[model samples]
Target: MTSPDSSAPLGVFDSGVGGLTVVRALRELLPNESIIYLGDTARVPYGSKSPDTIRRFSVEDTQFLVSHGVKAVVVACNTATAHALPVLQATFRVPIIGVLEPGVEATLAADSCERVGIIGTAGTIRSSAYQYALAMRKPDLQIHATATPLLVPFVEEGWTDHPALKSVLKEYLKPLLDKGMDTLVLGCTHYPLLIPVLKRMLGNKVRLVDSASTCAAHTQRMLEEKGLLRTVKSKPTLEIYLTDLAEQAEALAKRFLGTEFGKVKKATL
Candidate 1:
């Protein structure tokens, strides 16, 4: 229950390799801080799971990180954040953060963002977490939310530039675009990988609020507030763990984490 040392690595978890995007952002924003990342590939796509199951899985994920003596835990999965963030925070003494609120905050912070559209996994959109958070802050904000369940698989398959992906994206975004959405919130961690394609389709007018970068910024502020920012000047380390290491995990990790990708260990949880 005591305060974790600033030198301890920051913990981050996702249902799969998608959370590596958040890790990539954190590395850029807080270069001095080390990170411990866990990808629950064994139970990938928490989006379709029940709230109770997601919560239980999330608790186990947090416990795995806490066992490693992390300073703070970042729930990098939108589905888990939507369903289990409160319980994780209450159960664990370490400062816990989620991608949901940061994404909402980033969306509202966009200039001239009147009509906002949010896209995420089925669980995230179904939970209405981003919609509710945005509404709570700006009651009059026009919001359109939908679950783009197919996008995740496409991204994982490394088909970002495939013609089929374009077709699917067009289909998924039509309703939101028709609603005159000026800004779009990529609610899931996996969605950032689709940004280049999304921008190509939506153009410069529709601002994209990426949860990965927003969450990293939020984490930096929280660490500052709690005096948990690492003071060491040496090169920071990154430890990658996965519940089930898929054959393509390394390539996928590279795709998500960019230059920060490294050896991924198999985690029991």
Candidate 2:
């Protein structure tokens, strides 16, 4: 039988430490719950992978979470959410949520069918996945997207605050700003690390819509609907796992999670 504490530890995964943003949001909203996070650091950028590859990687990631006894799984990568959510949910008995739908819904509520810019990794932009998703729901929206590969590596290198990053930010965001985008979707999970610079470059009118908070909201509501919110404990449990780069992963986690993870052990499934 599944333990009553089954829902206590919700699983969260990303291609890298960027998903810690999702974890941060979850902690604020679901304070007493337990969370299990996995970052596939060895394959740190899922954004450029083929759809088939992303699906397979997501399966392995979720399987790793299930092995840790989590009751829910959150696909915290936009690329994975764009391509792999269905298979992850189908294979797992527990609830599965992804970042894209929440982000899309957020985008839908933010602006009309005006120009919307999306900046992500080369794979995400190349996939044309976001454009397709929005087109189905809001066909009139003029979608413009770019592949900001440097942003990902710059972010990964912990250069979010560096002046070097600011220069790279301008180059990556110039086209989107030129397109007169009213709303910009940070379509890659790692892109949020660059949000501050992105906002500075795009100005107040360009609403930056990222998926972490909304994903947390959905996770919160789902837990409530299922009566899974932990009321007995005042603090939630936090369990972190990484596929590789145990030390660096923990170091990067500090920037995203805003606290020292101390140690992130390696795990395989």
Most accurate candidate by lDDT: 1
Q: Rate the local accuracy (lDDT) of all candidates.
A: 0.92, 0.82
Model 2 misplacement above 4 A: 1-7, 111-113
> Which candidate gets the maximum TM-score versus the true structure?
1
Per-residue CA lDDT of candidate 1, range 101-140, in tens? 8988888886598999999989999998888999999999
Per-residue lDDT of model 2, residues 64-156, tens digit only: 898877878899888888788878877888888888778878889864538888887776777777888888899888889888888878887
> What is the alpha-carbon lDDT for the whole of candidate 1?
0.92
What is candidate 1's CA lDDT for residue 45? 77
lDDT value for candidate 2?
A: 0.82
Write down the TM-score of every candidate. 0.97, 0.91
Model 2 compared with the native: what TM-score?
Answer: 0.91
